[model samples]
Structures are given as structure tokens and as C-alpha cells.
Target: MSLTCGRILELTGNSPKVVVACECLAAGGKTWVLLHERHGNPLASIDFFLKDGFHLDEVLGSSEYDFELVALQPGDRLFMKPCQPHFVFGYAHSICLDPAASHLPNINDFDGLMDLLSACVLVILGNVLDFRTYRAPSQDEYEKANKNQQILIDHEINSIPISERFAICYARGVALRLINWIRMCSEIRGPGGFIITDLPSRFFVQIAQTLIKYKEGANASKLDLQANCTLGMLTKQIENVVEVDLKISSLWSKRHLIPSGSLALANQGDYSVQWPDPGRKKWSSIERDFMDAGVTPLDRLCFDTQHDRQHLELSVVIPQLKSRSSASQHPPKRTKS
Candidate 1:
């Protein structure tokens, strides 16, 4: 059975495409749609968003640029480039052509396909929310919740005389795994040394709540163990990225104090020198102290020489810092008398 929406329009000899339409209701907070790559970068697409007061942010390299909030009346369209990451947030509805559908054989069941697509998108949004609001539940609370959920599952299994429990369990497991994969991908830094796109943490929380509603309606079991594991991994990755980013930002902020000749050495390790005591006029003593410490004007020591993946990643961010330093008007600090 083909899943073609028949809403296909032909413009300028392009291949026919399937239309995916999404409507987001106002829930007192922002709603976001992030597209990291266009149909895996093989197909072309055009997006039409209902103007209704939405904000758009374009991701460039490691920075977010060109933020605009505009209201479009119905029937307005935006052209998107392949592999370019962009996101639209706020209450709105959008219709876009699916480039991935080009690879599929004829789709005749448009309604069914659309329903399936919508359900999948909704679940992903819910998973995002679950990830955003994830906190380590207390041991007691976790056990209690697990026990209660298990009881419910057992009751449902007994109610269904035919044994389909295994199928259901496997499906749930796959879903849990898929959610983990998505979380991991979302946290990964792209080639430009930035996350593919910035998503507000609360956005994922909202998605999780929505998914919970669906799970309740479907009477599906939650894979607590898998979810917890995925959450732990996500938390660790987030912490590591935050630490590195903080260090990079701090180094950039103090760039004015670093001499150009010493910048490369500083990247390798922290280098410190004792300033002469002006109050006591003890230049001779300061020279002797420097000699005792084996510290030269350009001497640098790698206190912690072990290189890790995080440090390697910082190499990409270093160029951006260098550019900022060059653009600054402040002169480098005088380190020598």
C-alpha cells in the first residue's frame, strides 16, 4: 500500500513529493521544530510556515546567527538548503515536502502514512521532554514506581489471553534504544565545534509530558532501566561539554593579558612568572628567585600533560578565540619592565 498524501505540487520540473504538515498548539511556552539535515542530504525540500508569530534561528558553524521573529499569513514559503541546520520556535503550523520520500516506492495510502509520521514525530518530541526533565529518582521512589508499573503490565498481559507480551516488550525496548540514540546525537558536537542546534531544555520536558499522556492512553510499559541508563550517559556528556566550554570562554576573556608570542605556549600549559617587588626595590632578589625556580621569560611547564579527547576538541575552538583576540582594541598587557 502506497502512502502518498496526493498534496504534491509540481513546480519547474522537480520530482513529485509528499507533504508533511505539523500543527503546534499554544501551551503557554515555546514550541520548536529543529531540522539538522534535509532528508539525509539527498533530497531537496521547501518549507511553508504559517506566520502566526514565530521566531526563527539559523545555526552557523559554532554560533547562532540571524534571529528574526515574523508573522506570516497563510501560504508563505521558505526555501531551505540541504544539510543546513535551522529551527523555528513558538506557536505555529508548518507544511513541508519530504525529501526522503523520493527514495520510497509509490505511496498510495497518504492518510495512513501521515498518521504514522505524525505519531513518530510526537513520540520523538515526547522523548525530548523526558530527557529534558530527567532527574535521578530516589531509590525508594524508583522501586515503587517500577513495581506499580510492573503490576499494571502483568494485569494487561493476563487480560489479553493471546500471548503478545513478548512482541510488545521488544517493541518497547527498541523504542527505548531509539530514544537513547537520539539523545546521544543531539549532544554530539558537529564539525563546526557546536551542537547541531540549541534546544531549550524545557522543550524536551514538554515533549516527555506529552509522550506520557500517549503512553497512558496506549497502556504501554516504560523501560525504566533503559531510560535511566540513557539519562546517565546524557548527563555525563553534558557535564563534560559544559566544563570545556567554560574553560574556553575564560581563556578567551583573559586573552588581552596574554602576549602574542606566549599564546602558543599558554595553550600547552599554564606558565607563571614572579613579578619584581616594586615596594622593596628587590630586583636582585627577584632575579635570584627566578633562577632558583628555573623560570625563564618564555619558560612553560605542562603540569598536567595527559591529553584527552576534550582537549583535542578545544583545538577547533581555539581559532575562534584567536579571531576574537585579533579584533579586540585593547593592547596586550605589559609583562616586562
Candidate 2:
């Protein structure tokens, strides 16, 4: 596309791609980019920004939003990461080619299969939420919304050609992953349920009695639990079977365990036993329960040993061992020998 002087493009986010300029840029050519880099949170819907009546330049310039300004010239290539929000401005008449392509990641075994699946899940989630326009509907509305989501999924799956075996497989994986996310988002008792309602509260989880550091040799036991049970209650149950003292220390789930604030202290064995704040007793006590962390059925849990007082410390004082400095200073009294 050719752009006149001072012409600016609107914001857009799509698959990863490389934009190559066909001709030399006249005088001032630049692209402003804002990337959604936080892995913990889902990508914000486009409607989220447009509906808020925000000016692109103003928001981009603000300190609250992190963005990058890139200058491009003749033969220059601008590589945009997956799902990044960006706009372009050309000072002079210039031509460019943008062919959206998938870039392979460093993983060799699956060849970035998980990344592709994640992108698919994001796309499906956007469709499920109707571009994030609505929130917290009644029971009837929730059921109707889910039905719409299923219809959309069916239409999408049918759109893929049957001959494309790889594409079919990908669509199936996306469907399964989407189901897991929908379940997590569904909290029926109150306004918490975003889409689905009245899910079962009882579930099974595998509890590993050993410390997380020694998970390889740990003995895992299965337990039944209710969604309303707190972390402190669960700890007591494990204590009865394991016959050991347990601390409200670091407990880990299958994929995520440590909170963002507790990451630095994890290595020091000072894991936060509570949610939001470690020391506060408010909000149903300090310890976070299964419902708060969204621990569904069949999720795995493990403990960290550093917080346990009974665990023996295995360390040898280096001063108690023979050293080159001590040997040089004493000389071992070799004359006696």
C-alpha cells in the first residue's frame, strides 16, 4: 500500500508477520507498536479500546501503556510478533508488502504446536465473548450465549476443508482447549459466572505429599474435595494421611503455582500462603482456596519443603573442610614426618 506524507494507519492486531518496504522511504517513515506481552492474561478484545473513545496517539504516548516507535527505510523489514497492536505512518509515498506468515519458535519437538493452539484458543475466546461487549448475564442468557458459542464453533469447524488433515487436527485441539477455558470462566453462584452456570462443586485432585523439589520420587495420593474448601482445610486432610507437619507454605498446581509477587521469595522458601496479600487475614483468611485459584477436577498439587521446619538441612560448613589457604598457612608440620 502507498501512503501520502503524514498518512497514518489505524491500529490492527493479527497473526505474526513481516512487513517489507518495496521502495526507499521518502523522509519520515515510522510504525508505532504496542505488544500484549503478558502471558498470564488473555488478549484484550479490540472492542475494549474502540468502545472507550480513546485517541491512538494520546494513549500510545501515555506512560501507562508501553509501546515502541520504529523507523523504517528502503529494504528495511519490520517484524511484528503475534497479536501485537500497531499503526504505521509514511512521510513519503512508499510501497510495502505484508504477507502474514507463521514463525516457528525454538521448541524442536512439537515445533511450536502449543503456541499455535494458544493462538487458536484466543481467537475462539474472542468469538465466545462476542468481542467482550457483554458481561455477567442471567441464567437464560448464559445458556443462550453458550449455545451461540457452540454454533459458532460448529460453523468454523465445518468451514475447514476435510482434505486438510493438519487443519482438522488443529481445529479439534482448539475445541478441547476452548472447553477447558470456558469451564474455568464459569462461576455460577453469583455474578462470577461469565458465561456458563451451575457447575458441579465436587471434584478430585492428586496431592503429592513430598516437596515440589523432590516430585520425581514423591508418592501422590488422590483426594475428593469441594469447591468451597479452603487451603487450610485441605492441608489438614493431607496431614492426617501423610503423618507429617505441613506448613501453609508454597503449594503448586499443574501449570501455575507461584503468584507474581511471590516469585522472588520462592527460591528462599518464603512462599505466600495467601492470595492478594500474604499477611492479611481478611477475604476468607490469608490462604487461597481452590475456587479462588480456579483449581478444577484432576488438577495436581505439590508442596515445597523449604517452609517445613522438620526437614533436615544438609549443608557442610566450608571452613570445617580442608582448604588451600589453611594448608598454605599451617604447612601440616611435615618436619615431624
Candidate 3:
């Protein structure tokens, strides 16, 4: 809540975060917040900032990026959308409370939906990068090491620069948990869907290349693809690794949820729960080329026999139609008669 002089929250994306400035002691007390807004700063610019040692001025001044720098004074409240790349800086001693969670706006149009989903993609990639960057300390080292420990056990972690400590903690534990939570919530259902974040195929290719440079390994089957390559060619390339006909879905296609009463039954501070297999899409795109279809090297093109896919589609559609038919038969709520 209170930041000492010259303290920084570091560069990270926590969409739907609100910072309420409560008080400021110093004469020039202010909180500098940098944000990545929709259709503003490109991801490439942020990526450049990350790779180039996180210099605040360089990125902000270098290009005509749509990044916002909000200077908050006492009694000021700032709200940010989901997956907006942002960081906070304390100009002088100050107090602020930052509470962030998914708060999606009413999505009535296509552009609004696109904006929301695009932010989610940025979230996924940002977390992935964090996961790759931070190495968690071993249990032994973690147990023995403390902030004030004279003889540090987690020397590996201790050696990390102060600027990255928050990121390290986030990468080690928070990143994967958040990723799973987002994936679970972001379903492609109707209006009732949770925050719908998706990763585009082209962006995946770009991020994959960036990861290669950052020394992270891609553990999936590799296929050389061009923007002009047809889906048939892609299928053929994938055939090398898979036996059955493949159906390409967005990386965010899968949906998962915790079971009912799973949390209510927890005791002895044990909150562990097992998740079921993720639900896959019953329908897929019929586009021809990789460019048109948006298939990338990193997108997991799940394999399914053509017959099986058709069967799954039928299974889903039949149940839906039956439900609709059953609903229509029920009389509408009648006024007093």
C-alpha cells in the first residue's frame, strides 16, 4: 500500500487492475503508470522494451506508441483493462492500493470483442515469457533462505537483480496458475462466456521465434510452414508426426472447470483438487491456406479422424436441438388468469 521513494512495481500485465491513490507525503509525490491500450502500442514495441533491459524512457519516447503514462495524485483512481501491459513507479513516498481481476466491458460489437481477446493473447505470451525467464529455487534452498538470512541458501535466487524479484515470484508460481485459470474461464460459448482471451497463429509464430532467441525450448513437433501454404500442405507436414487427420483449433480452444463442491469440502487447509480433461471444440475452421486459416507452428493442431469429428459435431448439435425443442414445448409464464 505504501511505497518508499524511488520504488517501482516493475513491468507486468495485470488486466483490470485498479490503483487508488490514498496519500502522498513528498512535494512531488506521484505514481507513474505505463499502460498498453487497445489498438495503441504494438506488442513488438513492448517486446523490444523487455529485451532491452526495461528502460522506461527509451520505450516511451522512441516511437509513436499508444502507451499511456498516467501520473496519479492523492485521491486519484486509475482502472486498466485486461492484459494491458503496465507498470507503476513511486516518484516519492506514497500510498496506493492496487486490486486487479478480470472485469470485461459489455461486448456489443466485433471490435470490442477483438480488443478483449487480443489483450488475452498478450496476457498468455507475457506469462509464457515469465515462465521461461524465472527459475524457481529448490525446496531445500527455499526452506533455508529468508530475506534476512545471513547465510543465504537460495543463492541462485538471491543473485537475481532487485528489479526482477517480483517477476521471478510471478513466473515461478503465479504465471502457470493464472494461465490455467484464464484458460478455464475463457470458453467460446455464447454471452455467458468468461473473459475470452485467445492467441492468434501469426503472433504465436512471432513469439515462438522470440522465445528461441530468449533460450527457451519448444518441445512440440516441428513443421516448417509459410504464409502461403495450404491447409492440405500443413496437414501433410503434420502427418509426419500424427497418424490421423488433424483438426486445427486456436491455442485457446480447450475449456476446463473445477468440479462442483470441490472447494467447499476442503479441510485442514488442504485446497488441492484434480482437474478433468479439457473439453475440445466440436467444430473447426474450413479455411484453405495457413494465412487464411491462421495456423502457426506453435498452434496445437489436435488430431481426430474425419468421421470422429463429424460424429462429435452431430453429438453436440443433436443435444442442443433437443434442449431447444424441449424448451419450446413448455408454456410461457402466464399472468394471473
Write down the lDDT that model 2 would get: 0.31
- Model 1 scores worst on lDDT over the 10 consecutive residues at 295-304
TM-score of each: 0.21, 0.26, 0.30
- Over 1-337, each residue of candidate 1 has an lDDT whose tens digit, in order, gives 1121213222234643333222222122222343443223211112111112212434455332233333333343333322233454434443333444432322123222223333433433221223322322222323323564434322221222222322332333343333332333323233344442222122223333333333332233332333422433343322322222223224434444433311011121121112123522422221222122221111111111113333866888898898888868677787997
**Backbone steric clashes in candidate 1, count:** 12
Roughly what TM-score does model 1 have, to 2 decimal places? 0.21
Q: What would the C-alpha RMSD of candidate 1 be, to one decimal place?
A: 30.1
TM-score winner among the candidates? Answer: 3
List, residue by residue over 192-259, the lDDT tens digit for candidate 3.
Answer: 33322332332233333343422321112223222222343233333221211121123212212211
Considering lDDT, which of the candidate structures 2 and 3 is the better prediction for this target? 3
- List the candidates ranked by lDDT, beginning with the highest: 3, 2, 1
Which of the predicted structures, 1 or 3, would earn the higher TM-score when compared with the native? 3
Report lDDT (Cα) of residue 318, candidate 3.
97
